[model samples]
Target: MKKENLIFGIYPVIEALKSETDLDKVYIQKGIENPKIDSIVKQIESLNITINFVPIEKLDRLTRSNHQGIVAITSPIAFHSLETIVEEVLASNTLPLFLVLDQISDVRNFGAILRTAECTGVHAVIVQKKGGAPVSGDTVKASAGAIFNIPICKVDHIKDAIFYLQGSGIRTIAATEKTKNSIYTTNLNQGIAIIMGSEGKGVSNSVLNLVDEKAALPLLGEINSLNVSVASGVFLYETVRQRTQ
Candidate 1:
């Protein structure tokens, strides 16, 4: 077993833990009771394998092969520190513009938003380590390959990111329908970070509270909301317009 490879079944996972292969994470079937399994769990805990107790059906679905009521998914991407990315941007000569997505799960929307962010000269796109969609091939294609060029940093918390950006002299703006202030009225000429939430649910409460300004797109039609990606483009390009002015 290798650190990069996935090892299924309780025994294999236990053996991997005993050996040199670092266990990234483990998924065990919830409500399972077995003495051998208990011993395996102790070893996994000692090795610091991030354990997730999931339904038995999930383990079955992931593999037709015998999973022994447990599975482990190998780590895909090495996480980049939010502080490091922001520092790198601030250390550079140019002003910074960042896009922070809160629980944005749709790959298409993520891709389109990234495309817009990159085109609008945003320095980086930050997202939570979990819940958000991965930078998959489809996302890259949807972004028209902008994913390769634009820097993306995964953080533990969105609020922390907002605070960090503000400390670095970057304003945090939230795009929400709940706000009456129009995006047009907000000054995006300064270094700033725009936070956009998912399609159904807007910005998380934690992030909403941290935004320096909560702005909305002026909508005259009956529709209550615009597509998240479309709305993001409006907000991002607005910054471009203000900067160009």
Candidate 2:
């Protein structure tokens, strides 16, 4: 986290939101309430921005200057629009492959997934505006600068993105342990978008229902699931193998 990337004070944060600045998250002093703060909360909710309520001590630790009980962290990189990226990909004659992440908050996991996505030639990595990990310095380092190379889109809802992708004739596949279908058995040589979920909750039921198919990697060990990043790599490489073979 860099000080240059943070914007504090209620009015400044509100203005940033109003201007449609790309923000990863917002922090407010817990239990503090005022008309301006109320308005900020409303704006954040309407914009679907992630926010946290923390102690004044935490805010002081974050910055020495007067934060006025509010702070906003800007993303290190700009986000692309899903529709715009999809249109560009569809215009190309080659089959399009995309990765959609649902609520993957761990910066390290997010970065590793991006690395794999770039290596495997994924067209774009889509994440939700609220629950996805911030494109912070840590994520950039973890991706080994691959974040700068790949297109990333932040959508308001994962379900809406799924529906839009399907409507465009791209097959959407979800990786989950709950499904009996295996990725090895699924066809990945066509235009597709693969959905990977959070570490704790996997994909949401609503999103799982919308995908064209659900597949899982067989786990030989006792562990029931793989790390989100590792599983994503497996899914991506499988796509590569099928397309190349």
Candidate 3:
């Protein structure tokens, strides 16, 4: 974490939130209570940003300067509103192609996925505010600057995004070996959102239960799975293959 990426002190964070700055998360020293902080917390909740109640020692490690019991990490890219993206994509002639990430913790993996998503013309990416990698400089590098070319949305949970997409008439599918359905066998020519899970856990059972469909890439190798990024690319191109035909 670089010093330039951090915003410390009370009023700075309040202004950042009010101005709709791209913030990854906020760390507040536990036991510090103030009315302004209460307002900040409310704003954070409204924006669906993550809030961490860390100790002063944690805040110290983040910055040598006074953090005033609160420090916020700025995101390298601004986030799009999920509703706005959905409405724009739905109203357009372009197909509503979205990628929903379920806890992709590796910044490198997340960036590579974004690269593939951009290359394949994904409308937008829906990611959870927490439990995922922050959009750091490394992420921007791995994305090959594709991060700027794509719109990303941060939500409180991925499942709710799936519901919104489904309600808007977009099909939601999960890429997991837990299902017998093959990606090639499944239809991807229509409006769809593909959910790629974490590198370790494929997809949470809760999210898996709500998705409209579950798909798996047929692997013949001894290893049962592929790296999440490679798998994401394969899934993305397959959709491209389907739609182009």
Candidate 4:
């Protein structure tokens, strides 16, 4: 059964897989144990498609009809290659700005961030393929159609993308509260890739250690943190302001 981008039921998903369907991710209910499920899992693994094991209730909420503990979410927008986007941008003679998302699981935040990235003239938005939020219909709606306007790259690892951007002469900056230096004092006019982590944990320690610089948003109001999307806008527009000023 197809509902928007979702293709549910066991046979339907198997058919989708056989048809070389472009699925964003497939969700299988956890701890069911079946031969067909094992076969489907192996097939999905062989194709390198993202698969998630979720609770039965999740599959229930995803669709009211019989799902057989399987559902596939398809992406509305085609993803671009990071190397291609970087190469095209470098050849253009424009200051490059890229947004790298680490473990951003919320579709709304992802969409809002994409909107902000597009508005700020970011060259491309990079996200880890498996761990990040799936580009579902909600994500497209949340992005306010900006997902279609901007180039998005899905990478295997966020660190490798950071390394490539760094090799390309673009500074990798992680937005984290761990650093005392704020965004206002940091240089943003240069080619840079800003890494925004999840809302709850901020940037990972491993990622924080690898960045060229770590900058924080000043928190004088005692909130300690800002929503990832809001923080992204502030950082992006700061770069915009610096460039315009």
Candidate 5:
């Protein structure tokens, strides 16, 4: 974590939240009771920022300075809104190609996907605010600075984002082994959004139900599944190939 990316102390964190700063996550000391802490909790809840309760020892490990039982990590890049990005893409007269990440918690995987998306000319990447990986220095490095080049929208839920994409005439596709359709068979030249699930769990049942199509990469070897990043690259490049041909 970079020093510039972290804002510690209770009052400072509260002010940052009030000022609408782009915070990745907030860490609060567990079992701490104070008026200011309560106020901060209320504001964070209202803002829908991800918060974690940790022990004093954990806080001590994070910083030696007086943290006042709270620390907020800021995102390196400001998140884009799904609706705004969609509107802009529509106005641009180009096919809308979006990548929706479902609970991809690994920073490296997230960064790798962003790199692939950028190389493939994806219009935007959408992720759920709570479960997705934070945009940190590690992620920026893993992305080969491609994270800065692409637009990332952090929504409250993946399912809602799928609904919005479908309503906007964008076909939503899920990449999972559970599906019978192969990526090679799917038409990706049209406006589409691809949903890639987390490493541990495939796409959530809720999101899978809403997607317009389900496509999977053929795996003939012993491995049951490819890494999420690799799968995303395959899907993104296939879309590029389709559009180009």
Candidate 6:
């Protein structure tokens, strides 16, 4: 089995940039600024590649190579464009089912939700580019490889994504505990995009305000809420049930 698939060393990572690859992220050693490095950073940024500034020690821990102060991890699956996916799905004249995540950073939860999304026949998963968990190997494993089958799009902002989806004729639903409407009652079978918040604080106010519907899963238990992943499953399967019926 391939135990590790990290592309370390500055040159190797730079070379990977030329090929058709989805890079999860790149780590650059702190305080190392040169023209060559600056140009490479610009290239990555231009390509919408995510980069992280880290200590050299961290790079060493990631690999034993003479990394020359850079490391890049290849994503298990290529990412899809939110606009393209929405346009194509809508062009099919079918009601699109999209899942928009705002600030959910836990890898396991992200992966688990993605697995449920694929099984539920979701068209795409939309996430904010920043403050989101890196789609690493662990996420791929946790997702049971569902990440490869489903479309995932990283957006600069959730609110912008909401507006874009709305303009594309997709209804945005915010899943929050504060809402009185039940998820089961919502029309998930239609052209819908569900927005799920972070595990810690729930959805942001800005994002929530833009949602066409704010619904919640019924809390029959005394806990008052469910884990984000479990809640996501409930929400996604509800859509599946509605569409099948």
Q: Which model is ahead, 3 or 4, in terms of TM-score?
A: 4
TM-score of 1: 0.71
Candidate 3 Cα errors over 4 Å, as ranges: 1-6, 10-21, 24-73
Cα lDDT of all candidates, in order? 0.81, 0.90, 0.90, 0.89, 0.89, 0.86
In candidate 2, what are the lDDT values of residues 1-245, reduced to their tens digit?
68988999988887898787987678899999789998888877665567899999999988889999999998778888889989999998889999999999899999999999999999999998776677776788999999999999988799999999999999999999888999999999999999999999999898998899999999999888899999999999999999999
**lDDT by residue for model 5 over 96-205, one digit each (tens)?**
99999998988899899999999999999998867567777678999999999999998878888988999999999999898889999999999999999999998988
Shift in Å, residue 149, candidate 6? 0.3
TM-score against native, each model: 0.71, 0.82, 0.78, 0.80, 0.82, 0.79
Candidate 6 — what's its lDDT? 0.86
Shift of residue 38 alpha carbon in model 6, Å:
13
User: Candidate 2 regions off by >4 Å?
Assistant: 1-9, 24-73
Q: Which scores higher on TM-score, 1 or 6?
A: 6
State residue 191's C-alpha deviation in candidate 1, in Å.
Answer: 1.2
Listed per model in order, the count of residue pairs whose N, CA or C atoms clash below 3 Å is 0, 0, 0, 0, 0, 0
The pairs that clash in candidate 2 are: none
Winner by lDDT between candidate 5 and candidate 2 = 2
Residue pairs in clash, model 1 = none
Q: Model 5 misses residue 223 by how many Å?
A: 1.4
Alpha-carbon RMSD, candidate 3? 5.1
Cα lDDT for residue 119, candidate 5? 94
**What is the C-alpha lDDT profile of model 4 across 1-245, one tens digit per residue?**
35788999888888887875667788999998888988999987765567899999999999987999888887688889999999999999999999999989888999999999999999999998676777766778999999999999988899899989999999999999998998999999999999999878888888888899999999989678999999999999999999999
What would the per-residue lDDT of candidate 1 be over residues 84-190, giving only the tens digit for each residue? 88888888967678999998888899899989988988888998766676555567678988887788887777888888899989989999988889899988888
lDDT of 2 at 223: 86
Find the 10 residues in a row with the least total lDDT in model 4.
129-138
Better of 1 and 3 by lDDT: 3
